[model samples]
Target: MISFVIKKGTNSNEMRENNSSLITANLLDWYKKEGRDLPWRETSDPYKIWISEIILQQTRVAQGREYYFRFIEKFPDLESLAMAEEDEVLKLWQGLGYYTRARNLHAAAKAVMDRFNGIFPSTYSDIITLRGVGEYTAAAIASIAFNEPHAVVDGNVFRVISRLFGITLSIHSSEGKKTIKKIARSLLYTEEPGIYNQAVMDFGALICTPTQPKCVECVLQDWCTAFAENRVGELPINDRKIALRNRYFHYFHILQNNSTFLQKRNGSDIWKNLFEFPLIETPLPNDFSQLVKTDFFGELFGGITLFSVDHKLAIKHRLTHQLIHTHFYQMIIPEEIPFNPPKNIFKIENEMLSDYPVSRLTHKYLETI
Candidate 1:
């Protein structure tokens, strides 16, 4: 397979011919002076770039930088990441709230080994085919790593472009997405697409901020439709308000002797491939009194009688599109595995459970107890 040819010269002027002449020049000039000195930005390695992109997506750059350095030091190459144990990976990603990103990083590493013989794919299409590589991520990798002249229309770009072009379409709307994508692609300067893409993203994040953008300092202030029309706050329109789905998770901290019943998640959802206590999720909150009466419950707590009910802890967590309200019921059980909780919930030593990648709510409870 042919690899992307690395650029041998620095030429920002020629690339500006395709985009809004004013915006391109100003954006690149501002980036050269004010762009954050990110470790990933310093290298062309797709592996490092991919890791930084995933981390930054879920966290602010300041907070993500430390983790980025730590993670890179850990699994520096794709082979190391592929060979690392899942528990070790999760432990490295412990404080990072979105555990799915860590899981995908590991999965994609293995995928690269099995599919591409361990080398990271170089083209936009190949990168997009990897796990967790969406259009935005793919565009970033392709342009940043291989200088593919594709545009990355993330939130920052959405805000900048909507206001610059005076577009009134809701950014979340299909029509809005179509309009912005077309314009973004057209604006992509193919000659130095990598630098051009980075400049626009950096310009949007730093200058075209969500609130009180510095229009006087912006290069294309005169051409900006929203600014000219005195409606900078309303250009990047969005209509969708996420409806939080309330779920009642009753985690039976079922103890049989000194052991507890736990299981790792198996599906393609948040908390997937993580471990958790035996959980009973009801649409609405479950009545604790009735739940305790089930005969199967006896199998879990055979030796120890129910002491006082521990204080109930309620926690809320959000996923891509789901909100989880989890309630923990901590119980004391003996050392033996109970027969009642099926194989779906595996029996494990209480002391060793820390190695499992449990949910944040569960992690909180475990930390306290």
Candidate 2:
């Protein structure tokens, strides 16, 4: 029934230290009773921890669970992953989107093997040097695996810190991020940094969720400035709008003599190194007749004089910042015709289709037939 709020003069060394201790103690106690039981939290192995971290990025915990298990089963240790082929790694990560993360995981594994003699880095500085590792992931690995004193400032932590201190800055801004990071460090439980880090993250996930948070039963409600000011939802401000672009892709699935044609995506585009049916991207949606008149369609089927379109499928795939409108055209070329595809295009037996890794959209199309 009492009200508690952290006001100005709270930035003083003594006041900050007192508030930090109180927050740490309360968070750890709450975590002990309400923290979610997760597989990644059970181990201090950097390999497993690193894998879980990458998989969880832009992916939900429920979805990431199976991927974490499957990936660890396939490549249990750093040595196993470093020696494995990129195709193998990508194939294992087929359904999971944001494929660049998987590639970076593989690359970082090789770096650890070659640079650190197969041992994972124990410090934040060294871990951040690996491919694809940012400050957050590096801090997580250092604290959880090595018991180092580093505060993790993930989305959860950002929200919790923002609301607790009543920060008015947009989380998307550099100044707001810097302020949150400073506050996170001040509140970190230095003695058990790993436990404290996970505790705060768990608190944010379970009690201080993004929507419909359980504020009534929240342990930090007394000290939550947003709660006192009736602005819980407005505390963690992120007003940046994502600019989404639309792309149209016409995919040709050429079937001939029990074989199909596929091309590995190259260059600095999405789905790089992944295999899919021969594709031509257009600015706007093009029908079958309009498609045949394009330069790409001409170059693709230049050698073949005749072919029949047996089936057509259209799919709209959505990404974080792009909306992909894909059309699949299945063409059956007679065995008598000698077809010479482009140099980048390669022919593979139908049975070998599943052996190559494709994007999620391609995988869905494959499931239909």
Candidate 3:
């Protein structure tokens, strides 16, 4: 039999009213038997836990595992990561799509060093002050690292709680959030919150998954309201749907001798600070012939009269809110022509291209040629 102590809310009456104690106990039991043996779970260090959590955001566990290992090997602690440069950090986080997370991690590491005297904050209040540390992440770190009884309400928790309670409110609504969070708080087994948090998260991940939940074998199935009502698939209602906007990019990979021009992306846009070939963005997709005739195209290569061009097949890259249709063009400029590119763009040796961090879209194009 598993024990549960309600950290918040009224008392045993509230526990019995919601059957939270039983739910929590069964969840912990399920976790003990079926929980994943992830590398992050083996340690109690807040720094490492923070790393694992940030990496796992917008990244699959399988892919993030290797990145985590490599990242830890390079910058093991807050001090190490704080001292390191942004470029080196970005380079290490090359293939990770959400570059902003890496940047925030780097910034947060420096913050930990400056604000907390190189020590990771123990309390949720202090931890949330760090960059990229939201309520979910802060709760995770505070509870898992310092044994603070802060219930983590991520997508997994949302799904599991909604199904277990057979919630019908839209998850996007404030009422839904309050209801789910309240239930989560009530169900948090406060005796060993670190273990309990991990258990609930593991139970959600392993048994009550998003798409194809193993309800038949789930320990919580008997207690699950959605299962009892035969509405498991429809309980967790989410009304938000992303409307994707399309943009077209024509990247010019101009080569003069063994060197090529690569520019660092700037501004508050996608792929900021990452290196890429000179790009001309258009409202709609355009072919090379149409692209060459554009005003922006002429401004870039107005003086360069003698050049050979070879266009590659257009590639479509999809992101959360945007769809990018990218076209890569390889141009060979003559050695004698005074080719002056944009001030932001600098010439780099073709052999040294791998040194700088680039977007995955740019990397894929590089791999082809």
TM-score of each: 0.84, 0.94, 0.95
Over the stretch 1-369, how does candidate 2's per-residue lDDT look in tens digits? 213555532446676666667777889999998887989999989999999988987788888999999999999999999999999999999989999998999999999989999999988999999998998888888899998999999999889988888888999999999999999998988898888988987888789999988999987776677888889979799889999999999889999999999999989999989999999898987888898888888888895668989557789999999999999888999999988888999999999999999999999899888
Task: Give the lDDT of residue 10 in candidate 1.
Answer: 18
lDDT against true structure, model 3: 0.88
Candidate 3 clash pair list: none
1 or 3, greater by lDDT:
3
Write candidate 3's Cα lDDT for 188-214 as tens digits.
988788888888877777788888899
- lDDT, each prediction: 0.78, 0.88, 0.88
lDDT for model 1, please. 0.78
Off by over 4 Å in 2: 1-17, 303-305
Candidate order, TM-score descending: 3, 2, 1
Off by over 4 Å in 3: 1-18
lDDT of 3 at 293: 90
**Regions of candidate 1 where Cα sits further than 4 Å from its true position:** 1-19, 255-259, 293-308, 334-340
TM-score of 1: 0.84
Clashes of 2: 0
lDDT of 1 by residue, 9-54 (tens): 2123343232355456667676788887788989999999999988
